[model samples]
Target chain A: MPEISYRQAIKDALAEEIERDENVVVIGEEVAQYNGAYKVTEGLLERYGPKRIVDAPISEAGFIGMGIGASMLGVRPVMELMFWSFAYVAWDQIINNASSVRYMSGGLINVPIVIRGPANGGTNVGATHSHTPENLIANMPGLKVVCPATPYDAKGLMKSAIRDNDPVYVMESTLLYGTTGEVPEEEYVIPLGKADIKREGTDVTIVCHGPSVSVAMTAAQILKEEHDIDAEVLDLRSIRPLDEEAIITSVKKTNRAVLVEENRPFCGVDAQIAYTIQNKAFDYLDAPIQRVSTIDAPAIYSPAVEPEQLPKAANVVEKVLSIM
Target chain B: MVGFYREMVRIRRFEERSLRVYQQGKIGGFLHLYIGQESIAVACASLMGDHDHMITAYRNHGHALAVGMSMNECMAELLGKATGCSKGKGGSMHFFAPDKNYWGGHGIVGGQIPLGVGLAYGVKYKDQKGSAMAFMGDGAINQGAVHEAYNLAALWDLPAIFIIENNGYSMGTSQERSSSHPKEGLAARAEGYGMAWEIINGESLFAIRDGVGRAIKRAHEESKPTILEIHTYRYQGHSVADANAKKYRTKEEIDDYRKNHDPLNVYRLFLLDQKIMSEDEMKEIDGEAKQEAEVAAQFADESEFPTVESITEDVYWEADNPDKRTSEGRLFFND
Candidate 1:
């Protein structure tokens, strides 16, 4: 076992996959020469050469669709979107080509492409650049969505996404790149639709994913020390193949639930979780399910208000207390 | 020569039969007939070798037939039957036979362009001597995705052939009303991307062989990209639903194309004048083509619709193979 940064873990998974699969190639804007916008894909161009580490222009629709097309012919392309927000320009390709093509074509085709990049809004990057589209992308059925919060989960999930036989979208956070976590020095993978209980308790359940997972963990610690409320924190690593069983089981035991997410509240990923908890574990509930989410508006650009806009440990604790 | 004639006739006859079936309310959704633009697909498909790939827009029944897609599956697909190429999942606008290098029958106007470049990219990546012929209508040229594809193709020197089937009208808008008519024609826009460009009279199968043939060679031998603006015509409306086909233009113009630029009549006349086939033999071939279309129509007419149990089929690879499903969740959301 060893410690590694989340950014380095992603690089390791990519390198390992590239070494194993000849058909795997990295295609994106500045992924090669520029070493990625966040320096996540540094040294890959030199290691794998131009054929494997391809640099695409700032045309998300063009290169994304190109990766999908190549994937059909067995060229496993891991497409990098500089920011997942840019994916809106190529909505037709992602929705129609990448996601629905296989189903539409009656399984005559398969788009084994992985679209991965930063997808959080903590920085002061304004309204457009800051978008948490995990819910939006996961809303589509033919696609899979994964958001890795820790270095260990990041390595495990990135490898799984590349090898998965469907179109998998990996949403990472620029804020979590430098964060360190323990990762084993052996071949391992984290399966999709599985949740990890970061901390164990029985008073209340704090279910979250990606960036919100850390906030949940912090809120759990605070609830124990200040309010003396022992909260169980559940991290959903994969979004689409959502771990409903894990979420329900935790809620049943705790008898109370507080969902924390970085995205908006209107039809957010948490909305699905709330519905699931009420639908499945209605009798087990001790209180109505509560949610802590980013302020219901465009992401603020101010350094002061932006932090206020996103869900905080204080917000999660407040939600937990209200439910208690 | 006779083989080409048979394929062209088969496609034309198939389209006519499909159009009839469409009117009869047997086939659902949009049916884009490829009545006049037959020789272009016949010639283009004739040139495809071991590694060559082909993709086209929604009006793709012609290319599907030209690439050897059996009329049974294609017609069944149009009729929304289980035995269709896409198993009734994709109707007229999404026919596919990937094993034959026929990528698909895409619905979106310039959407297939980038995918075509990817096909060429895959070919070049594998060191295969192949090219991808991505076909689009005249209206698709204005789409932003097509230009992005053009830039990528030229920038990478991908073995891509962008075949713009300039059929004069995109849905209801005519070429004059919709596009900029440069001196060099619509495909002159390729010049902006520094890609090689050409124009061919799509009425003649011979002209397609010479023009599309050259572009394919450029892609295969030099791993370069080319844009061929093939001047073709469509006798049918955008879809069978486009009732304003005659209102957008005059009856005389449509009649003029039907009489003069009809690839079938022109190529048949050329074959007869060159002594490629006798008049009696040509008549017999037409009879056979019509019979084939009739059989396909009969099969599609009688075939069963997909089963209710198979409604969620083909959405994911894991759905079909539960044993190998890596993720643990409900792939299908049904009651």
Candidate 2:
């Protein structure tokens, strides 16, 4: 196993897919020459040339719509939205054409497209820049939303998303881009909607993803040593095809649940997980489902409030202890 | 010009039969007939090779029939039967026949503009030698997406021909009332995007053929986008709802346009003067076109509607499993 960062895993997946299929192209702002806003496409431009690596104008609506048009002609495009905040300008293309084209076409077309970008709060980018829009995308029926918490899942799931015949929304967190983990250097893939059980325990089930998955794992280890409460941590890789069975199985085993997310509290991913738990396994629960999420407010710029707005290991521990 | 006269006759008789079917409640949904813009489709279609692609606005029955879409399929689609081009799913507004290189008969006014550029991009990306034409109405020129498409096509030097059928109205509103400047619509707008522009009278088939030919050649040779504005008018109301459309425009104005600028009459006069077609031959051609449209309508009337049991089918790409209940759970969330 080779250790790689989350950013490298995404780059490797894109590179491999492009090399495998000549029809696969990448288009975004600064994707061709500047490598990408986050350097995730650093060496792709030189390898693929200008035909495969397209640096579009600053208009998100124009390029994203162009990607859809290209996809209609049998070219699979992996579009980068620069940042999650910038996607608002092209919401018409994403929601109107990208999400609804399949159902509206009555199965005559398959949209093999991916819109990848970094989401969630960190690095003091202010309110407009920092947002975790997982729930907003998950609400759409035609889109498949995936957010990998580690390097292995990022590489494997991204490869699967690129090959899938549906539009996949790969929501990455800015905080998790540089984080490193063991990634296998072979022909392997982790299919979409398969949840990974990070640690096995019997007392409490902790569900998380993206950057918060790391916090949940750390909290699970601390609870095991100090509090004497064994916590089960499951990293949910995809939100749209959410692995509800694995979640119900864990909840059925532990009899207690704590849902953690970095997004705001109202209508967050935690609410969906908590709702599913209560609806599916209400009788199996020992206590009411508990949620640990960022506060419901515009993210403050100060360091003091930023930590509070982010789901931390200590907060996960507190939520898990409270539920146990 | 002779070809334009025959195509206009065909379009006129086709739509006349269609209007009758619609009156009898045989056809459903919004149906925009291309009666007045006959010369424009013929003139522009003359420039397209078999390898090139074409996409157009909702006023598309004539274009689809002209560009090799079987008259039976187009009529069946209008009748909302299962044998239509989109398998009876897309009505008069949406018809996609990829085999004939007719990308779509899109409903959105300016939606096909960017897709035309994408087709041109694909042609170039695949190292093919052909130009793509995107036809839009005068009303669609006001959309923002069209401007974005123009800029991108110019920025990339894409070989795309953007033709605006300046029929002087959008639904019920006239161009003078809707737009700021009445003179220069899409042709002048192309100048801002650094593309060449041409303005031609759509009533005159000779002028339309010359203008479209030059535009296509320029797009192919220079590898640059071109905007061609064809000044035309619609004889019918916007759709079936416009049967009594006297509130929008005066009857006297419609009479004057029909007398002076009717594309079929213009071409018939040219053909008669050139001794290419006699009065009897023209009458014979009109009768043949009427018979063809009548036969197509019969075929559409005999077709059947799709069964209701296939409602949940084709929602996704072949991921059906008996154990999964929800659509998403079957494909992405399988245990």
Candidate 3:
């Protein structure tokens, strides 16, 4: 096992995939000479040169559409968005073209493109820069949405998404990019739609993905130490092809579940997960299923109000305590 | 020359029949007719290489026919039948045939511009000697996506030909109302992106063929993208649903253009003048075109809808592959 940052894991995946497949190329703004906005694509331009690592203009729709078209013709393009919020400008290309091309083409064409970038709030980047659009994108049928909470899953899922023949949206968090975790140096891929139980417990299950996984883990630790309550922290690595059986199985064992997410509560991923639990595992649950999510409002710019808008570990703990 | 005349007639007859069928409530969804703008697709398709690709906006029946898609498949697709080009999933607005290198009939205003550039990028990346043509309307020229695509196509020197069919109106609004610099024409904006560009009379097949031929040649030889603005018109409303086109544009204007500048009639007269065909021969081509369109309608009407079991199928390609599906199914955590 090797200790590496989440940013390093993503770089390793791009380097390995570019080496493995000649058709694999990375294209985005500042990805080439400028490294990257967040430096996640650092050193790729130096290693792969200008052709493999392309620098695009400040045109999300233009470059995103180019990636989709290139992917249709057998080029695996890893398109990076400076921030996922910027994807709104390219929504037609992302939702209509990339997501529906294979189906609309009668399976004659497939967009093997990975759209990767940071999609997190609570950084004080204001309303425009901060967005958690995993729920918005996962609502599309032809796309696979993956949100890795650790460096290990980030590297493995990036490699898998690159090789997959469908359009995959890799949602990364700026908060998790600097976080370090143990990752294997060998070639290994964490398959999509699998939920991992980070800390097993018998009392309550905390279901989460992306940045909220850490919040769940912290709350689980606090609940165990102070409240004498055992909490299970389950990390849902993939959001589209949701792990319904894992959620149901966990809820059946723990008899209680709470979904924690950084996205707004309206039509969020937790709403679907909570519905799945109540629909499938209602008889086994002793307490009602609860959700801990960001408040349903525009992201605030102030640091104090921004933290209040986002889901904190204390919020998860409060939900758990209320359910108990 | 007679071949071009025949294609124009065929496209005209097909569109005329499509309008009739749409009025009869046989065809559903948005039905955009290529009634008056047949010469652009015919001339451009004639100049393309076998490996070159094409993508266009929703007004695509003429392009599909010009690119060699059988009339039966095109009509079946418009009628939403199983045997259509897109397997009936894509209606009139989304016709596609990868075998013929026809990328799509996108519905969005300027959505296909970037995809067309990407296709050109793929051709260059693969060292292919063919180029790609992305056809849009005059209204789409204002889209930021199209501008962005133009910049990249020039920067990367991708072999892409962007054809803007200036049909004067986008849905209902005229180009003058929508364009920022309508007085100078859309081709003038291409210069800002550092792309080689030209403006051609969309009515003349020779001008279209010559302009597109030069652009295609440059793309094949120099790997450069060209912006071609073809001044054209659509006789009917934008779609079958927009029968109120007369309310916007005067009938005198419509009749003036139809009587003088109809692409099919112009090309027919050109063939007769060139001694390529007699009056009898021109009449025979017109009759044959009408007969072909009739047969296509019959075929589409006879074709069945897709099976209900296939509703969930083709959503993803991997789901169609049994081996991959089973193996990937095993990889699921629940399984």
Candidate that would win on lDDT: 1
Candidate 3 per-residue lDDT over residues B35-127, each given as its tens digit: 889999999999888669999989998999999998999999888888988888888988888888899989899999999999999999899
Candidate 2: share of reference interface contacts reproduced: 0.23
* lDDT per residue (tens digit) for residues B1-335 in model 1: 99999999999899999989998999888999998999989999999999999999999999999999999999999999999999999999999999889988999999998999899999999999999999999999999889889999999999999999988999999888888757889888888999899999999999999998899999989999999999988888999999998899889999999999899999989998999899999889999989999999999989999998777889888887799998886555443
Ranking by lDDT: 1, 3, 2
lDDT for each residue of candidate 3 in A293-323, tens digit (9 for 90 to 100): 9988888899978888888899999999998
Candidate 3: stretches off by over 4 Å: B182-184, B326-335
CA lDDT of each candidate? 0.92, 0.81, 0.89
Give the C-alpha miss distance for residue A298 in model 3, angstroms: 1.4
* Candidate 1 displacement at residue A137 in angstroms: 1.2
TM-score for each model: 0.99, 0.89, 0.97
Q: How does chain B of model 2 score on TM-score?
A: 0.92
- lDDT of candidate 2 over B92-148, digit per residue (tens): 887766666677777777777876777777666666667778889989888877888
Candidate 3 interface RMSD to the true structure: 2.9
TM-score of 2: 0.89
How does chain A of candidate 3 score by TM-score against the true chain A?
A: 0.99
